[model samples]
Target: DACETRVPLVLCGNKVDLRDCGGRRGGVASEAGERLARDTGATYFETSCKNGDGVVDALIQLARQMVTTEDVAVQTSALRVCAADQKRPCCGGGGRKDV
Candidate 1:
């Protein structure tokens, strides 16, 4: 059966290291990212590819959200059950039953 699911969201601001380079302004502020995240109901993260900051943290948070989501749990359970059923022999017989 098809079901509706609310997927978790994450807003990532990349290249945060650039913001600190030579005192030159870079991308949007962290506060702006946070505000957008709040408005969109998503988790916010700032990552720098050069320094590898917050990259793992963001991935971890996203993974946590995905595993903890209700719909994912339900779907996983259903798939397990289906797999178990598929393992059962047809006509309630295991292998070829001797007549």
Candidate 2:
């Protein structure tokens, strides 16, 4: 499942340094990653921290997108679930406690 939001979403596949690190580096294919980005309406980026590939470029792209769409409304789940749980008129909010 994918998280849906009215915000600029950038999907990054990191640790790409393992791509050529022998057979122990099996991971998601690039074609599938691109398909997922298309399906989710997000920008895709393949980054390798070791070599710093696509790191700055991806950040710049996301920053540019955020700047251009700054007016979009963001629906944060903290506000969503808390609003639904408040039974009183002046309830502050509800927080989740992991068991």
Candidate 3:
């Protein structure tokens, strides 16, 4: 499903520490990755497999966004239900409930 849906992709270039020490350049393909991310309106991150750089932060940020989005969805649904109930006479009182 994810392979078919091409929205909200996250491109992570890992193992940066091994690149320079092994005669390989880190982020060499960063531009290409960035271009792809930009084209798809996705996020790009460079991480080091050895030292764990940017890993926690990236995951935390993603989690935070997910939580925020979920919260918004919950609130929106609650509001919709409240509005619908208010429009109906047999579904409890029309007044808002105290939280």
Q: What is the lDDT of residue 47 in candidate 2?
A: 84
Model 2 RMSD in Å is: 12.0
How should the candidates be ordered by TM-score, best one leading? 3, 1, 2
Q: Model 1 Cα displacement at 78 (Å)?
A: 6.7
Clash number by candidate, in order: 0, 0, 0
Candidate 1 lDDT by residue in tens digits, 1-99: 336556788888888888978988876689999999999989999988788998899999998888789667687789989999999888777677569
Q: Write the per-residue lDDT of candidate 3 for residues 25-93, one digit (tens) a residue.
A: 665367777887688776777777679987886677667766766676677779989998778866475
Instruction: Identify the candidate with maximal lDDT.
Output: 1
lDDT tens digits by residue: candidate 2, 11-41: 8878877878867675457888899999999
The TM-score values for the models, in the order shown, are 0.65, 0.60, 0.66
Q: Model 1 misses residue 66 by how many Å?
A: 0.6
Order by lDDT, highest first:
1, 2, 3
